[model samples]
Target: WQVFRFAAPALMAGNAALLKHASNVCGSALEIEAVFREAGFPKDLFRVLLIESGEVAALIARPEIRAVTLTGSNRAGESVGAAAGKALKKTVLELGGSDPYVILADADVEHAVQVTVQSRLTNSGQSCIAAKRFIVVPEVREAFERGVVERMKLASCGDPMLESTQVGPLARLDLREGLHRQVRESVAAGARLILGGEIPSGPGAFYPPTVLSEVKPGMPAYDEEIFGPVAAIIPVKDEEAAIAVANDTSFGLGAAVFTRDLARGEKIAKERIEAGSCFVNALVKSDPRLPFGGIKESGYGREL
Candidate 1:
């Protein structure tokens, strides 16, 4: 949010701003309007349309909306993209990622392992760039796998309304269904499980942190992004193989390489990644100033 305070002026310069906030955060939508209104923006110049889902298409197709910016589901991105495409409106999509977290042999063993686990479950694993896949080198694969699984099991999922809850509820019921389906598909495809595949006992949509090893390509767990606390631990022979496994996914939204070797980090960041963004020594995600998007089916437009 701090980034936006600085970035919005530079990016929105000479361009009218149109915002489509997430469905659940209407209060945030109104707050955005208040900010613009407080800035003395003309009523007509800054409009926040909190309309029915069906009405979004009409608004996007209007001549007034010259460009579209979105930070939400990939499915939502497709609908917005279609409307914008039809109306010839420019689109900026900050689609969330099923990002990969790569751990090379030369990576700092303890720090890399700890951060990998943390990144996987950060934001209740709700982040687009929360490290979804943990790709580890052969030498450290067993250690990394054990470390991640242990940490996952220790994740304290409970009431978000609680002060100490580490994991919160899904935004809604349907999202939990989607996550459950993904988990089921992965298991059916024969991926080895490490921990937490079932929903915890609660009214809230809570799944314990899940860990899987021997995640071969083509398995639902390997190819698809598990949006929950599910972790896919894929083994690679060396740095080159790690890069290959990292790039194998349709998503190149972001990547993290944990290695002291700065040169190898550069190579992975420059040559191996298919993502619009890359993180050499840290886990990857989006920011307001730095643009975020993906290649292939992930979407084309960048968000800044």
Candidate 2:
């Protein structure tokens, strides 16, 4: 609700907003519309467009729609951005991320463990900044491995409807299959799977939360983001190597640094991280008070 936390006041400030969420979250979308209506917003003040991806451009091209904001794939953002551009209108996008999570030799093991465990489990690891890349310095690799393994073992993997479930199925069938393919290809490219390599046998589109170790550059997994529960762990020899590996990917969405040395963290935060937002000594999470966006193929513009 962080979004609504700040956006509600903005909405009340006379500027209306429309939301076109993921098709799977229709119920939540409509309920958001209801909240605005109940708050005495004009019927036209808050609109929910339950539209398909194939038709977003047409909707955004409407003469009344002055600006458009979108959150999804880079392809989707390009389409919407192009359409809005053609209309000579403003458009903002919060596109997908292949964010990196880095831990230097001086990192706090327990702190990194707690944060990485929580980062990978956020929104069941379907989040944009959910720590897709786990880069650790060699000196701390074994301890980080042990820490992550212990925590991963503790992650509840079962029905989302269950109160104790920490991991759930991917959002849709295609998402499941695509992530599975990434796993297969990444493994084929010599990436070692310390955890979760196979698909879970199930009726729903469920994929077990997975972690990969010995992730080196040149693998397809390194080149692209796996948009599910799978996390790729990369170990580097030094902080420079870690920074190089972290920035090697095309994505520049969010980058995180976990280290005890505040000076080094500040240096990386200011100079090394190639992202719209960089977090020092913390995992990245979006906020309504600050704008969030991406650079490179992750897409462009901002959203708050």
Candidate 3:
């Protein structure tokens, strides 16, 4: 999706695309080039380069490469942005996010929980716009927590190739370890572990659907992005507190607000929540017709 989002427009504008994809997904990148070829586009119009990260700076410095765009972690974004700036080239960065979902008192508890769990577990919670911090008012916090735990617990974690697998392993073992470390540190810092928090005894990099409640500002679950199937639930006093908590993070990629009143939801989404894409009652998603990007440390410029 990310590749096509940029490649489609560039090709339509008669520009060739050079894809230097992440090493872990090299197979998919090759397949994408093959897809472009099979679709009857000119050969060599879209090409994939299997190169090391260190080689990118030199490639960007070349005059042939017009602009640079990246979708990765903050560290990688910083490196690429620095290189592109040195080369005096245009750049677009779609980096990390710790998206928040605000649940008000009037929201249907069941519906909010269903959507929150779905958003959190999408791509095994590896998405930049996946719901990370769930801020709920006191009126619905307990009910929302209970419902989220039940729904998350029901998700089946297994092989990605299986149709029955609702959850899959992390992309790498180090990533799983990093996510587990965050969960442990967050719990040690006073977050309550209400659901799966342990690393399962498995052959794959599979972490269970974990839930942490009472997530506060200092804890990792509250402070950093957990790139796995872990949900952080933060309880706030009222609507004002909820909004404050939602915007407390440095990331401003995406956010959602749930309320029974459509007008109230829209107002909060439009005015209160700080994000590039704000959804009133649905999960934050990317559409080709709408611009997709982030603000603050989440990076700059739109993709589609």
Best by lDDT: 3
- For model 1, the stretches where C-alpha displacement exceeds 4 angstroms are 1-7, 10-16, 35-46, 161-163, 287-289
> Tens-digit lDDT track for model 3 on 1-304?
8899999998999899999999799999999999999999998999999999999999999999999989999999999999999999999999999999999999988989999999999999999999999999999888999999999999999989999998999999999999999999999999999999999896999999999999999999999998999999999999999999999999999999999999999999998888998998899999988879999999999886
Candidates 1 and 3, the one with greater TM-score: 3
Model 3's alpha-carbon lDDT is: 0.94
lDDT of 1 by residue, 127-219 (tens): 777888888888888877888877777878887778787777777778888887877777778878768888767576777788878888777
**Which runs of model 3 end up more than 4 angstroms from their true locations?**
none
lDDT of 2 at 247: 92
TM-scores of the candidates are 0.89, 0.93, 0.99
Winner on TM-score between 2 and 3 is 3
> What is the number of backbone collisions in each predicted candidate, taken in the order shown?
2, 0, 0
Model 2 per-residue lDDT tens digits across residues 53-129: 77877777888777776777877777888988988878767777888888999899889988877887787788888
Instruction: Tell me which of candidates 1 and 2 scores higher on lDDT.
Output: 2
Tell me the deviation in Å of residue 186 in model 1: 1.4
Q: Is candidate 1 or candidate 3 better by lDDT?
A: 3
